[model samples]
Target: ARVAGFGPDTVLLMVLPLAHNYNLGSPGMLGAIAAGGHMVIAPRGDASTVFSLVENERVTCIPAAVPLVVNWLNDPALDRFDTRSLTLVQNGGARLSPELRDRLRKRLGCQYQEVYGTAEGLLNLTRLNDDDEKILTSSGAPICDDDEIKVVDEDGREVADGERGELVTRGPYTIAGYYNAPAINARAFTADGFYRMGDIVVKRGRYVWADGRKGDLINRGGEKINIDEVENLMLKHPALHSVALVAMPDPVYGERACAFGVLRAGATLTFEELSRFLLEQGIAKFKLPERLEIVPEFPVSGAGKILRRTLREIIEAKLAAERSQSAGPRRGP
Candidate 1:
């Protein structure tokens, strides 16, 4: 937690499951203990309990996922609790939109740190002393001085700075190979040993900017739609609490963009309204989701990352059922 500016006086609130590598091995947890800081573990699924812990324990630092932060911001009980004691807020596991970052800073009155890391052990972090512009736009510089990062194309050749490419890294803490998974290890690492992180990123000077997962792109009639880009724009809408964009099967276009959203508590939004909002954001017409699904909650992994593959399966199955119903039984000759 020293890199994040946590100290012996810092009281940290741990809400994420300890089973996840991010929570178990994070500097926020280990460094806090090393510094003799107090750690309070909060119960899952209740935002009120978290707020109460922060207010009662005077929590100074919190490491959480982006979705949890979004839920806390959307909770009506936010204003009912005193959260001024919170000073350091670290978010990882998912991308934090510039809009959400600004809102968290203003509402929580805390310094927001955006961390970029992988389960495989590559870590990049933005410091607490970083300016708002750097914190909002870049995911921060590498944590270790000797850590190396490279953005490469399909041929494994490094790309120019500021150009988007798959991010690869090699560092002291990074894992060399997965246990008992030789097949995966072959494709997941380079000949020289850099791990392929499967994320597309752009390097601008000292900072790296994430552009979403390489496989998360949706091709709608040869046009590629960056899922994270659409989700980030959608999250800027006042009614949305969470959003996941996936590609749905479309016979005509081959594939179409579909957005699944969870509205804020007691808030209502229509597909037309959401589409109009995206249009106003200056996104291309083809990039706008042709279909919308309102979900109560998104399926998340143990690490708190949204299960977009599961969501795509749900929508594809529903479309198949609809098509089956539309086609009547064939009569025998």
Candidate 2:
């Protein structure tokens, strides 16, 4: 309640699934109860229902995903309802793109806050009064002074500020162990107790910036490309609506980056055009995507995060089919 600026009069609109910890526990239910505020649960997360509820309930805050905010901004029915009561829109469950952040504030006339947390530990959050650059660039500082966060290299040694490494944390609210998976817990937590977040982060003083998940790293001939960085760059293009970068199987390079994107309505973007744009942006040649697939939409999880694993599988299957077809049928000896 204190960190998120919740108050006794705050009417929080809960649109995320109740099963997720971000919604059922911290920030959503806990924040409201701690602040002595009211919560209106929506049956569905559709923009129409969410907007109408906000108008009717006079909701002061809402915990939403970035994609939902984008949908709301693009929905033609947005002007039909009154959303003047909304003061705070907190985003979680995924990295909120800088493009989306700017659009949210410009179109909604509300304060945008980004919360970086996991099911195991609720971590950083942007303050209400933070400057635009801090809100748009970094994921804010730790939730509390007591929350211990560290960015460490593979050897478990702390890295310098602005250097990317795995982020680990242990705090008052951080969970100690899994329910019944002892073996998994042994691998998940450090010997000292900090939960290994598996996210690559760069810290500067109090603030931290997420690069991508450690498991999501694309090792194209050991170049080590971060998929999140590529996606963020792709979002800057005016013709692209959404993008997801995944590792595709490469015979020589081991694994190459493949970008799947959704183009803006009635607009078009080709692989050559995107590659040229990345070159113009000063992106390193090694980090450029070797393949690009334009799609109508991305596969999303229940929490509204892009399902990169699913996209990788889709591309892998397509590649396998192509190879099989290329290898013509053999004749009897």
In terms of TM-score, the best-performing candidate is: 1
User: Residue-wise lDDT of candidate 2 within 1-333, one digit each (tens)?
Assistant: 788888898999888887787776557788888889989999888789998999999999988886787677767788898889999888887888887888888777899888887877756888888999888877878878988888889988889988989888999988998999999999888889989999998988888888878879999998999887788889888888888889999999999999998887888988999999998888999999988999888888888788889999999999999999999898898
Clashes of 1: 0
Q: What is the TM-score of each predicted model, taking all chains together? A: 0.95, 0.94
In angstroms, the error of model 2 at 299 is 1.6
**What are the runs in model 1 whose C-alpha is more than 4 Å off?**
none
Which lDDT value does model 1 have at 297? 95
Best by lDDT: 1
The lDDT, on a scale of 0 to 1, for candidate 2 is 0.86
